[model samples]
Target chain A: MGKLISMEGNQAAAEAMRQINPDVVAAYPITPQTEVVQTFAQFVADGRVDTEFITVESEHSAMSACVGAAAAGTRVMTATSANGMALMWEILYIAASTRLPIVMALVNRALSANINIHCDHSDSMGARDAGWIQLYCENSQEVYDTLIQAVRIAEHPQVRLPVMVCYDGFIISHAVECLKLLEDKEVQEFVGEFKPVNSLLDIAHPHTFGPLDLYDFYFEHKRQQIEAYGPAKQVIVEIGKQFSALSGREYGLFEGYRLQDARLAIVLLGSAAGTAKEAVDRLRADGLPIGLLKLRAFRPFPSEELIQLLGGFEAVAVLDRAVSFGATAGPLFTEISSALFRADRRPLLVNYIYGLGGRDIDIEDIQKVGEELERTAERGKTEQLVDYVSVRE
Target chain B: MRQVLLAADTPVVVANATGCLEVATTIFPYTAWRCPFIHCAFENAASTLSGVETAYRALKKKGKISQDIRFIAFGGDGGTYDIGLQALSGACERGHRMLYVCYDNQAYMNTGIQRSSATPLGAATTTCPAGKLLPGKSQNRKDLTEIMAAHHIPYVAQTSPGRWNDLVSKTQTALRTEGPSFMNVLSPCPRGWRFPPNETIKIAQLAVDTCLWPLYEVVEGKWRLTYRPKQKLPVEEWLKTQGRFAHLFKGDNQQVIEQLQAEVDRRWEELLEKSS
Candidate 1:
């Protein structure tokens, strides 16, 4: 049994981290993501958790420390936002390729160039190819639940890779909501003691990590990293099943809301999904053949499952919170289109880039997008392949 | 590099920065190191070892690891004095029980002799060529050992490889000290400094004799000169030994050599005053 309480998303993440209680947590503060570690640091100071909390100098050091600690055979975790994640970019790949199971909480924020700190998918979307298992959450509850699940997913025997739990900055991170907290014992039993594959502390069986691969083994090592996703994709689903059993909250690669029997649909990820759910309901009530596809796992793409779920749609509008610049479509849209490229019964896909720099996406906005998607279906063609929404003229 | 290893009687876990030490020893599937080792990145060896050391303390507090082990991080001057300075500063300020040794080869020796912050004045590097308009690297080398001392760590030392006994002793003292020890050892490079391979140790010895690279330690904020020359050699003794300084012997470059010598003498006097 668990207790229900109202708390902000960052506090919820901290509570989950307290329950999980990793051996080491090396983190630096960044906006929106700051309270997550700040609360966790309080837990450490209060002796609630015995984690070796290293207040590193920068995000680069934070990730570097995580890499070193993970390779040193300790369960490690961290949290950061956009520019901080960008700072950790170089070591992010190292953590994955080295097969170190380090977990990170990424509160998504827009990247800088005029320097903004607001909800956007640009951060984690930029790291989509960094070889980490990325999990996006819709609300505070999901932020809490996904963080705990992230630990097991990262440390699974078959999947020894880093996990990034992404939630929208300020939207989900600062917004207070009622969520259930798992008993500490329950989390402890679920994650168990981390069984490391290699330990730098093992004096007898010494191992060398991150060796110079050069021409001989670099490509093969990368091939191994690629093959790792096979088991990783399975482990993610399998652990979701196990988590559902305990928590009674079912999770999947993606969640389809009123999508099964619909002809027109819109796709999105992160906190905006909650807003879209109401729009989906309004569209369904109006007798429009409209539905919603809220993606949870962005990495491993859920191509096969997405094809089966979305192939019957007449037209699908993929809403992306981040633009892909010169690309033909947004990142989420690009992935969705590529996943459906060879589908036997694919829908006409249009991309809508929206809600950048924390711009609000109201239910009416989603309803309008759904109506446009409905019109696209009625016309039997996309009016435009990619366009912006809710922006100044 | 070998002296630091020999000084540690116990087994050690090593975190190496990306430089000659890491590249020369490791080449996938084959390594010269028998101990557990990691080379994370060029600019993060200190933070990396800090992680390892923190993990050791955490696990050991729980009675998990039972080994009497030491943690060591190795970086070159490029990684230490320049690129990785922030990480090194952070690690030192945090005060982890580890030894960070900068094998001070003066420049980015592994990258075709680029001028690093540790490159001495008037020493020609590819980035600061000794051309008609230029007179080699114009800036004096950074006083990195002093910089580490400012952190007020338990141990900070400066030594060179040619002084085998002093190098080994300094390493032993550093390892024995409790928190955050640092060593900036002048690891004479034959290829980058343009000296004969056999004269590597001789070049290092000349550096110390000329007070260009002195052997000293700052233990718990108290500075001490570890080794002092019986009869101090002129700075020209060090400059003449390395081909990188060969241009100082060329026409109208005498003023640059004088400036270099004056910088060395000023630093030596400062160290002496601090020791006194």
Candidate 2:
């Protein structure tokens, strides 16, 4: 039996990484996410983890080192957030495009200007097309859970792709909660020894990576990248199931709370999902037939599962933490809307852009949004559609 | 069209990054960049290539990778000199059994002609655009040969495509070197330099004759001058041929030209002293 320990999400991610026993943990520190690397660095310092902890100068170098370390044939890991993640922007695409199974823990934080280091989804959402398999965590448990699965998903022979496990800054990153720590032996068996497909370091059968691809072959190579998506989706579910068996917790591409036998539901992802779930519980207590759909895997989005889940609901309040600027709706909202395009009886979806730029997202705010959705259904009209939920003027 | 492919007796993987070498070599699919060579294109090829070399070294240490396989970074000047310098420095300093081949085209030609430290004095690039007040660039070319040489590295060489025999020979020598070796090749950019495509080799050769670029090597702390001109040509001739330096002679900055020649002479004398 595993011992239960209360820890913050950042610690959970760092602990999960430690248990994975990566060869290199090259990372830099950033706000709301600093503790993650600090914890790992301490682990390296104390000789707790037999890994090379490359404390790089900047996020660019952190990722640069990861590329080097990973290409060198060692299982490598790193963590960063917000401005730090933005700094690693150029290399992030390379890590995925090159198919290096480098895993990164992205502590989700808001981008600056107004300057905030609180919970937000803008950072990861900005890197949506970077080609890495993006996994969003609902809470600290998933933080510990997803990280273990991320390694398996990323290192799969069929899906040699980098993965980013994102948890909202401050919200889940600093929020203390109970996390079931899996045994190191179990994780070692689960993740296994990562034998890279065409590793740079493999001298027995020397194979060159990062070749000069001219215009003629660039597009086809990119198309081949698209082919990995299907395999990646399958691997995520497989790893999820495997993880669930090892640890007594259910895992899926998505989790539906009261999704069945409910006329209306609130669709959410990341740490905000917990807040939404609380709102669902509160609404249910008052005899409201409302539920919450929590997104676990984001990259190869579970569009079919989303369509099936929403098929029964009369309407969906897509609580998106990130806005698409000039687009029709939020990033998650847009994807959900498109997923429901072929539905036999489409639910009236209301896009609610909330918790933006590290704003505090109280469960009461989610309850307020739920009330709005209920009113939208009852009056056959949607007021304040595609507006900030509980945002202070 | 001519095609060449060969498999090594041992596993040999080459990591090439995006630059002129990448663009010129890889057109892909139809003219697929694929070769008997297991070539990978990394964004910052120097670091990526270094990573490949490091990985190979670690594997070799563990008896995972074969001892015979060659690990190399087919990096461009921009990738090696500017963008990926730190990684290259780390790899070189660590003495990884890797060959860092820098196709130094003088400027960041991949992203459009911008002045890199490798760009020669008085070259008109997009960044150092020609104007009435200033004649293109005013800084001297950074002696990367000296930079790597200072690292006390086992092997470092300066080669130019102008001298193909020397370039290929330098490549061979670097490959033969037991430890980390860097080959900085003067890969002439006809497009960036605003010269006729046919003049690529001629311009490269002229660069050497004018002492703008000298062919030499720093092997195990010993300097060896590979190619020296019978008669040192005037720097003006080398400058006048390329449109990038057209503004230099057209203006009253004859002093700048003289200053450039002086620095070239100083460097040449220093190289000669070391070679002797």
Candidate 3:
């Protein structure tokens, strides 16, 4: 055991990065995620973390710099919020496709238009298909815990891929909680040092990096990238085991709260899951037969785990913070519906698009959703409910 | 261009097509063009050229490549002024230290007198055939030189094939520069221009004499004229020499000729003001 301290989620994330002892951290500061990079910058300045902290121009350049640095055989890390993540959209794909083990922390926030600077899963949801292993944290402890596991998962020899650790903006990034901080030497041994087989700017060896692919072989490259996502499951499990051994904090692709005998359940990701869990506890006390299934690992999206968890529940409300606009449903809703479609006995999946553009969703709102789900379970009904908990006349 | 190519002691790779400039400079195995040039074909030049240049730089930085090779991409106007623009922009903006030279031959003479972007306004080509209603191409040639300069590179210049020594000297200066440099030279094509093949050099000289294409250099944010025509010839004289401009001599077509002359005058005045 190292030290138990009360700290904000951003502080936990920053301290975890320091303990990991990364080689290069290229980042641009944005709201919610700003403090993560700020604290890390201070660490670099104070001789705490001896790393190349490249203060880049934009999130695009930050991600671009990460691609360059990581490709050059350096362990790289970065953090960003909504628009910052939007700006990094291009090179994020580059980092993933090139198989650079770059770790990015995304402070989930509402995307834009009548902008709200608060918590939502909008940022990470948009990046779901970017070939990155995405992990969502519920609180400050998980923020610290997941970041450690993220590095191990991303840099695994079998799965040399980029990873995005997402914790809700302001809710998890700003909210304070008790966290178990790991020792620097302990984390250093756990993550170990990164050594690249090929890198840019290496004088010892000559190699071609990032060649433009035409139609002739571009599909095969992408097909191989898709294939890596499957192996990532094993890597994530192994890293989770290692993290539990080192820090006494257990992690899984998905976690359940009273979900074993659940007839009605609310499925969600990020900080909202914490509130859903609280709602589940209250409803469970009232003998409401409700539960919460919090998705921890969203990409390489744990389909089997989801089916197994939801299979027991009668009706499931899948809450998504992103709108896939003009589609039949929300991004997460479409995913859940598709994943459960082929099952012999599937749960009645309801679509709930909530907290978009960071509108606040309280415990009451989650309770309301839970009550609705319970009613649906009782009725043995199926309905796609969207934009729930709306302010009505 | 020898001044530019020979300035660096190491091997200088040149990517060129089988155009007038390539034919003039290189002959089979008894190659005249040197700086240890690796001659690449036109269509796939940019990508492969970049591959070679990047490999060399990465190798040299790692102490793998023995000689300090200065890579230069040289091609006709058809190559640099149009087809290769995308790759050129990528290379220059990506901070490659390669000098890209466009010997503006005015037409695709290598393929048979077809029109290219570097072709002058009112010049006729197989595609831009002159007729009763229209004289030739109404639009003026695109200013590729300025476009290269806009990339915020260290060096970009507009030299004339008429001034051979100056062209060679500027070519050398660009190759020695640390970053990407682009040079566009107006090398008149005799076959395309409907002039005696021997008059190729003389007509090219006349191009500068007539201010048809002025000789200038854009260096370190300063624009300076290297050659100023003593008597700016009427656009008619340059037009009359080229069979492509034969239709321009007809009635009402003279207004189009005047419009072309006026645009030239306006540009020359702007260049003079900039030179100051």
- Which candidate number has the best lDDT? 1
Better of 2 and 3 by TM-score: 2
The worst-scoring run of ten residues by lDDT in candidate 2 chain A lies at A200-209
Q: Give me the displacement of residue A383 in model 1, in angstroms.
A: 1.8
Every model's Cα RMSD, please?
A: 0.8, 4.2, 7.9
Kindly report which residue stretches of model 3 are placed more than 4 angstroms away from their true locations once superposed.
A44-48, A202-205, A383-387, B1-276
Q: Pick the candidate with the highest TM-score.
A: 1
In model 2, the runs with Cα more than 4 Å from the true position are: A42-57, A64-74, A201-224, B1-12, B30-43, B57-63, B66-70, B86-97, B109-115, B125-134, B146-181, B189-210, B214-234, B240-253, B265-276
Model 3 chain A lDDT-worst window of ten: A200-209
Q: After superposition, how far is residue A199 of candidate 2 from its true place, in Å?
A: 3.2
Please tell me the TM-score of chain A for candidate 3: 0.97
Residue pairs whose backbone atoms clash in candidate 3: A203-B62, B1-B168, B4-B171, B4-B172
Judged by DockQ cut-offs, the docking class of candidate 1 is high
Residues A221-252, model 2: lDDT tens digits: 99999999988888888888888899989887
For all candidates listed, what's the TM-score of chain B alone? 0.98, 0.89, 0.88
Q: State which candidate, 2 or 3, has the greater DockQ.
A: 2
lDDT of 2 by residue, B1-276 (tens): 010013123344565666766666544332243332333333355545545555454455556555566656676777778776776776677676767778788898888999988887778898888787767788888888788999888999987778887877777777778888888878788888888999988999998998888999988999999998999998987888888887777658778888888998899888889899
Expressed as tens digits, the lDDT of each residue in A1-393 for candidate 3 is 789899999999999899987777878899989999999999989988767666655676577556655765677888999989998786677789889898998998888866778877777888888899999888999988888888888888888999999998988889889878888888888888776767543433434344435567778989999998888998888789888888888888878888777788788888888788888888888888888878888788888767766765688898888788788878888888787876667887787878766677888888888788877777787654665565442
Worst 10 residues of 1 chain B by lDDT: B60-69
